[model samples]
Target: MHPMLNIAIRAVRQAGNIMTKYYEKMDSIESKQKGYHEFMTYVEKETRYQMIAIILKSYPQHTIITTDNNTMHTGDQHVQWIINALDGSINYIKRLPHFSISIAIRIKGRSEIAVVYDPIRNELFRAWRGHGTQLNGYRLRGGMVRDLEKAILSTNCSFKMNPNASPYIKIIEKIFTQCADFRRHGSVALDLAYIASGRIDGYLAINLAPCDFAAGELLIREAGGLVTDLTGSHDYFYNGNFVSGNVRIVKALLAHIRVK
Candidate 1:
């Protein structure tokens, strides 16, 4: 195992433990706003402190880009750890079991390694840039469902973001009408991890951050899936909008999204 993978492994496990504690003690939890979401608490802050300590202690010079604390990074470090200390904060706050601790380390901004763990489920999903995706320790690869109509799809919807006032709803509504199934799980990392394990056929998300999809990108690709922005561009980390699946459905989904 790469040394950095060990670091990611430790950080996510520790974060998960901290989350479980908070998950069990909801009455004492506090809430704050981050972006349009009205939720955040001590667990998010404390776990980040712990993760940063672990990652920085191992590689003191490594920069971090994270959603928990919004610490901006600058300079030419070869390693960057993109972290979402609590990916499903709202679900976590509600005592739902879908939350996860997500970590993905980018080498010069291209995430080559990732770990997404859900302590409640004892699920640890990982992927190296070239190595195949893994669950616990088993290697994983995706299935080829050539036709989109037969494929199961997953996404995080934004009726609020669109508020019946945007054009994106039509795309997902069409997907709902055609696919074998469609699920709306609040956790982006887990949703992508499921795609890697062949538990789901494909996924797309609007406005995914670097941390949200970093670890997931590797898992999807390593699992014999391809990833690209809706425009078919390899600029997902910047564009923050992308699709992933067996090669057959990838383009069709992109076409459905009408990405250039």
Candidate 2:
């Protein structure tokens, strides 16, 4: 294992332990609204602080980016550690055990390592740049379903009225017609990890931050899958809209999406 990846795994696992300790006492945890339909709790802050501490201790000179502040690049720019301490905060607050801790290491602006750990399930999904993705130390591969009718897709949906809601719903309806089913999981990190593990055939989401899917993106790609923007391009990192799956599933999905 790479030294940096080892440190990341240590940090994420420590953070996951913190979250698991708090998961059992949801009623006592207080949460505040961070944005429209977004919530934050002390668990996130504590876990973030713990993970950062562990990481900076190992590499004090490396740049660290979190969801709270992604643009502040002060430390060594050559290596960046992007972290989402609690990927599904809303679900955590609601006692839904489907959340994860996502950590991605980008060297020279290219993702080199990724780790997504689910504490409740005790499943660790990790990947190196050239190595394939793994779940609990076993190699993972994306689903082989090439046809949409045989695929089960995952996505994140917002109930609040927003400009993109109508268009997003329309796209979902169109895909629903062809796909076997859709699952609206609150965690994009887990969704992408699922794609890598073959739990879901594909995933699509709009308006997400890099912290949300950075780790999972690398996982999918390393696991013999593809990740691209809604337009079937490699601009998802900038556009914040991505569709990920095996090559055939992703191409089929792009064919159904009407990108305007």
Best by lDDT: 2
Worst 10 residues of 2 by lDDT: 29-38
Q: Which ranges in model 2 have alpha carbons more than 4 Å from their true place?
A: 29-40, 68-73, 159-161
Off by over 4 Å in 1: 28-40, 72-76, 161-165
Report model 1's TM-score to 2 decimal places.
0.89
Which pairs of residues collide in candidate 2?
none
Question: In lDDT terms, how accurate is model 1?
Answer: 0.80
- For each of the candidates, the C-alpha root-mean-square deviation to the true structure, in angstroms, is 3.4, 2.9
Can you write out model 1's per-residue Cα lDDT over 1-260, one digit (the tens) per residue? 98999999999998888878766656543433332234346678888888888887788777888883355454346777889888887787677789888888878657788899988998999988877789999999787688988988888774565464255677777667767888777899998888888778888777778878888888888889988987888988887886888898887787777742
Tell me the lDDT of model 1 at 4. Answer: 93
Query: In candidate 2, what are the lDDT values of residues 113-214, reduced to their tens digit?
Result: 999999999999999999889998999987888888999999887646677598888888888999999998888899999999999999988888889988
Task: Choose the strongest candidate by TM-score.
Answer: 2
Q: What is the lDDT of candidate 2?
A: 0.87
Total clashing pairs for each candidate: 0, 0
How much lDDT does each candidate structure score? Answer: 0.80, 0.87
